[model samples]
Target chain A: MAEPGREIPKPTPETQHFWDGCKQGELLLQTCKSCDHTYFPPRPFCPDCGHREVAVVKATGRARLFSYIINHLPTPGFEVPFAIAVVELDEGPRMMANILECEQTPEALVLDMPLEVTFQPVSDDISLPQFKPASQSTGSGSA
Target chain B: MGQKTVAIVGAAETTELGKIPHMSQIQLHADAALNALADAGLTIKDIDGVATAAHNPVELAHYLGITPTWADGTSVGGCSFMLHVRHAMAAIEAGLCTTVLITHGESGRSWVGRHGPSLFPSELQMQFERPFGVSRPPNMFTIPVLRYMKDHDLSVETLAMVSVIQREWAAKNPRASFKDPITVDDVLNSKMIAYPFRLLMCCLVTDGGGALILTKADRAKDFPTKPVYILGSGESVESPMISQMADFTSSRAFKVSGTKAFETSGISHADVDHLMIYDAFAHLPIYGLEDLGFVKPGEAGDFIAERNTAPGGTLPLNTNGGGLSYMHSGMYGMYALQEGVRQMRGIAPAQVEGAEISVVHGVGGMFSASGTIVLTNSE
Candidate 1:
């Protein structure tokens, strides 16, 4: 069927952890101990080293603002004029995330700007992970 | 082990794409099939096999009126139907079947619409990515595109150049969605669909049906249609989903798919007279150019600006206006094949003169699934 409205897909057992971390305002990536390869969208095994010994690691939550957009037209479920980004996470997974606490424009945003993870509550079962300019979260607001 | 010479003897289509709310999916399929049969001057009874794509294959068989000696519903993104041509060639050479009709019919934009089940991973892809407002393909693909821009030092204006040129090429095509004039400023100023990406930078959602008829080279001459021989074809799947991708800078499947196609066709980049790339979005052609070795990695944006992919330009690309302009029809790959066949036959609206060789590339997924087909008419 043609998607009628803004429909968000639900997380399954395999992806619950990733979603959970986002709910709590943390960016978490799965790392496999067998070969030490980290990845996003959480998988069951180490795709590269082929190991099953994997665990969720608290990401440094630090990232570089690789790219982003400020959307104007809102999907049925989303607010309009929100910011989105492809954050290069410290754990090695470059994730598609939202950038909150800032205007959605090239002038206010700079490439490779340091960013840190934050959370926005969306629903009872869903909490979302967004990023803020790293300086704001650090309190010093410099460098 | 060696190459083959299969040609396009038939082509067909139905009405406009999206939400007709009138005809059943099978009716659309049959209409395209019937048109192809007429295009090739052949009858349904002349075919020995059928290939189906989109929502349901068995349903297609039920509606088509007759069963084939060989049947396929191989679904790979939209371009999969074109990949079927190569498989059909192999099957024909193996004496399994002849006169294969490969088709796809879907209307995901509006009435009588269809989208195959999200297939588990995408369900999670939508969930984990969206609530944070990482919704839709433009947002999903932005991160990698960002990485591409940063690592390569590509400016947003450079990226905009790709779509702008494509829109210009699409202007000649009556089937295209955004034939209106567009400028780099227009693309830059356009509202953002995702970060650093705007509406003009994306492809439109259209609804329609398309078909291709192929058979042995010897039998093709007898067919009423002009034959555009299929030289080589290849397919590849690098990742199941975008989230699973390790690198954001390049598409491994595109590289590998083109490699396989060139091997099968025994043609090189130099042999190509035109390139009918699948441009689901502007970046797609850029990726195809790099992945298929038309340009060095990170050089496509510059190539588009400095080179001519437009009419009267050095490069005769997407003469039918491409997917960016041509009907999106769910899978733009099928239409690309149609354009390639037309170009080789010298019958396209914006025909590429003396164009004997062409390359039609199709990508599925988010740089995750890809296929490449090389075609020529040396004879």
Candidate 2:
């Protein structure tokens, strides 16, 4: 699961759909049919009401800035000054995605800021679903 | 049955929190052990009992320069310390040993190379959740909170109130990582780290060392000015793996442990004045309040926010500051017992008023293992 330039864990069968969707440039989640409650990582069963029927759905790809950290540690392949956010997907599930394309500071990470999903192609097969300001679009500068 | 009362006589700690790369975990545990023995008015040579949770067994005893005839390390993670305290009390009352020492230290934060190759043990790591990019503690916790919101028909506003209450509690203690006054609005509007959880709800990632000493009730009185008594104890592990748990929405271990502890102490939750439930994440206390029977199952979010668990509130809790504001050392269970002792002695700076009886509970490995100890002033 080593992407030539990336050092993240490889996705397995249970998590492949999530990675595949990210590869296709979409944010996805699993919803339980019995309870109709949305969840993350697309589990095999409805976590609520003990139902086995679950379905995959594209998220509105819209999220609210839930909470975040201003990391100063210099890890290779990742920006030292990066903002990692837990985004509240419009569908009800919350996912951990980084907030990119914005000032990498505390001021840029106000709670409830509107955001849109963006993917970073770590390896050819896997692209992590990160987010950035909704007003922003796909441009080149990363850091 | 000889004497059903026990209390902490000493507590000690080392400063290697967050990232300590220079020494083995054993060496770090030793430093804290020596400090605690000194605090208890005893030397390492005087300690004949050793207890720990999930260690390499002789690692702690060998490092401390004392090999007790009795040794135990149950390794339940953060909750291990409180469980060790209860075990020490039982061993002392049975005359198995005198002057026991408990310790823990781990470089969990720094030892593992992120992205390169995770050094975290395969069995111990979050195998089920981490692969989907849900590697952090705050993310896993968000799921339960989402369900709690549904079960109670509560708004996100209810959860926001918890951050403010804990921030206020943290403000009173210098040890907490966050001390400024935060508001419900600030928390609700704050950045989401995970759905249903905000930045303020997460415990700061810290790696540190802590140790405590226990002696026979009479031996405790001989040295320390106020040796707190351990009134009652209880422990139960419902599920080994978090994902396999039957009820992810509510914690079963906390409920069982709290109920058993209340029964062991011959009193109800109503008799308890100070409540120190683990706050590994902010939602922990919310789940804890319900499990410990303080509030109904779905009332924790609101119960905590209305000042029900603050310094001057009805349940005045976690006076030394919790993992939320204080230190989130690898194993903080023992420190919880130490805080209980301090509160009962009226020595805590954030002391709950008239605190004679306190209920201290610990949650280990997410919501898997739970333990409780009731400590009170010597009657």
Candidate maximizing DockQ? 1
Best by TM-score: 1
Candidate 2 lDDT over B157-257, as tens digits, reads 77766666767777877666668887778877766665556666666666556787887776667766577777787898865444444464578888888
Model 1 lDDT per residue over B161-263, tens place: 8777877777877666668888899999987676677777777776677788888887778887667787888888776556446567778888888988888
The DockQ values of the predictions, listed in order, are 0.41, 0.06
Please give the range of 10 consecutive residues that has the lowest summed lDDT in model 1 chain B: B113-122
Candidate 2 lDDT at B141 equals 44
How many backbone clashes are present in model 1? 11
The lDDT values for all models are: 0.73, 0.69
Instruction: Compute the DockQ of candidate 2.
Output: 0.06
**Top-lDDT structure, candidate number:** 1
Off by over 4 Å in 2: A1-143, B1-5, B15-24, B107-128
